[model samples]
Target: MSFNEIKQHSKARFKCESNELASIREYVRLKGLSLGLSEEEAFKVSLAVDEACSNLVKHAKKRSLSENGFYICLKIYSDQNQFIVEILDKSQPFNPNSVPSPDMQEYFKQFKRGGLGIHIMRSLIDDIAYFPAKIDKDYNVLQLKKLIA
Candidate 1:
């Protein structure tokens, strides 16, 4: 089936804030367990969700968007064999693909300041897809999916 045809099993929205990270992680972890994911698997998904939200907060601040004005919506859907988690943010439009893969040698050698969130997100999830803001729309959606074990 196509991406658009999947039925949403559950969803939740939270403000983009450092304080909300724990809540967001718990939200994803509970949903993951409900979907029959093992604790390890659920933790992996939760970490990915956490990283995404953290990155959004940083992005919003960089763009000068008010902390209270930024928000994230998370949708959990199943396609018979896997669970898909979609994270929507209305901060600033960015091309996730434009981020070059960091050279680990340099990143570690030079003591990088901040360039690992995307890497962690990619490593924890089975599949990651990003949607840029539409011509008239104000939000961008980042999708993370993990296959049922």
Candidate 2:
């Protein structure tokens, strides 16, 4: 669906600190379950969001709404078939293409600690899209979609 259409649907915005991650995860989890997702499916949704927020807390250097805080806007859209989640943040813009798909065998051999969030998001969600923040806009937008099975 178009971004405008998605934004017009059910949505919520969160401005919180790193410690507030659990609350955001719970919100997504409950929304997923309430929307009829199986527990496992809802957990996946929660985990994906958790990973995204964690990345921001770890890497983003932007000034928060309050000291040591960050802002995230979540927009949820539904139809007869699927659910779409859009997460917007003021984190640094990322070039998804610049990060190559990790080699699982090599990753295990090196025991890497980073670069796994994107992989997990891709694996659990049906589709993932990243939009860099434009010069005119101060936020990066990441969209995750999961199709009902």
Candidate 3:
């Protein structure tokens, strides 16, 4: 399919795992490039999306009840010069903005190994948002967007 075709596309649901993240990244990169993104911009979008997917894998594993794994939906828009990646998982709801800003001084003292995912994602993407799923309401929704040239 062509780039314009993809821009008009939207998938309602899909499942993914940590191992499958690479393929998803590649797919987003190609779609971004086709929509006029520079290689560097495409890479940034891919990496941001990968981080979101990885978060789902790390946090949602225990909550998954069936073989479906985690659900993801991607929407690409050329006219908008942007791509939206939405991930849904049965993990506890987390507000990215609510995460304590990283403190380098406390990092070593408190011995917290992780909590940088949101920081990295925010830096890479044009926008990020979190929302509680409306129905089948156990899941949390993470939305990310990156702008292309």
Candidate 4:
């Protein structure tokens, strides 16, 4: 089916494990393409989504997540002119923004081991917003938005 024939909203549930990363990226890429994103755009969004999910899975391995499901919800808001990808889990109260971006020159010079997830996500996604679980809601959300090109 072509992009114009696709629906505006969809979702998928993934386990909070590194094993699910490839599937997550594939889903995002396919859905992004069907939602009017170019192959390159879809890949970028997929990469960003992978980074986001990877960070969550890594952190989830460290702490206890009360929620069993990690969800990826996709929405195309034509009026708003955006493609939104939301990663929801009952994550602990931690802000992704707190991770400072590494200085590239220094990072390459010293050969940094790891710490580029947030940087990668931010670079590919137009906006990243974190919404903590509220009184009514039961899960923390990492919302990633990309302009519909």
Index of the highest-TM-score prediction: 1
lDDT tens digits, residue span 45-101, model 3: 888877777777776667565555466665555556566666666555666767766
Lowest lDDT block of 10, candidate 2: 61-70
Looking at model 1, which ten-residue stretch has the lowest summed lDDT?
Answer: 60-69
Give the runs in model 3 whose Cα sits over 4 Å from its true position.
1-7, 10-14, 65-69, 108-112, 136-139
Worst 10 residues of 4 by lDDT: 71-80
**What TM-score goes with each of the models?**
0.89, 0.82, 0.74, 0.84
Give the per-residue lDDT digits (tens) of candidate 2, residues 28-117. 888777776778988998898887777777766563333433678887776546667778877667644356779999999998888888
Tens digits of lDDT, candidate 4, 104-144: 89999998888888899888988888877778987777877
Clashing pairs in 2: none
- Report the Cα lDDT for candidate 2: 0.74
Best by lDDT: 1
Off by over 4 Å in 2: 1-9, 62-69
Superposition error at 48 for model 2 (Å): 0.9
Q: RMSD to native for every prediction?
A: 2.0, 2.9, 4.7, 4.8
- lDDT of each model, Cα atoms only? 0.83, 0.74, 0.70, 0.75
Q: Candidate 1: how many backbone clashes? A: 0
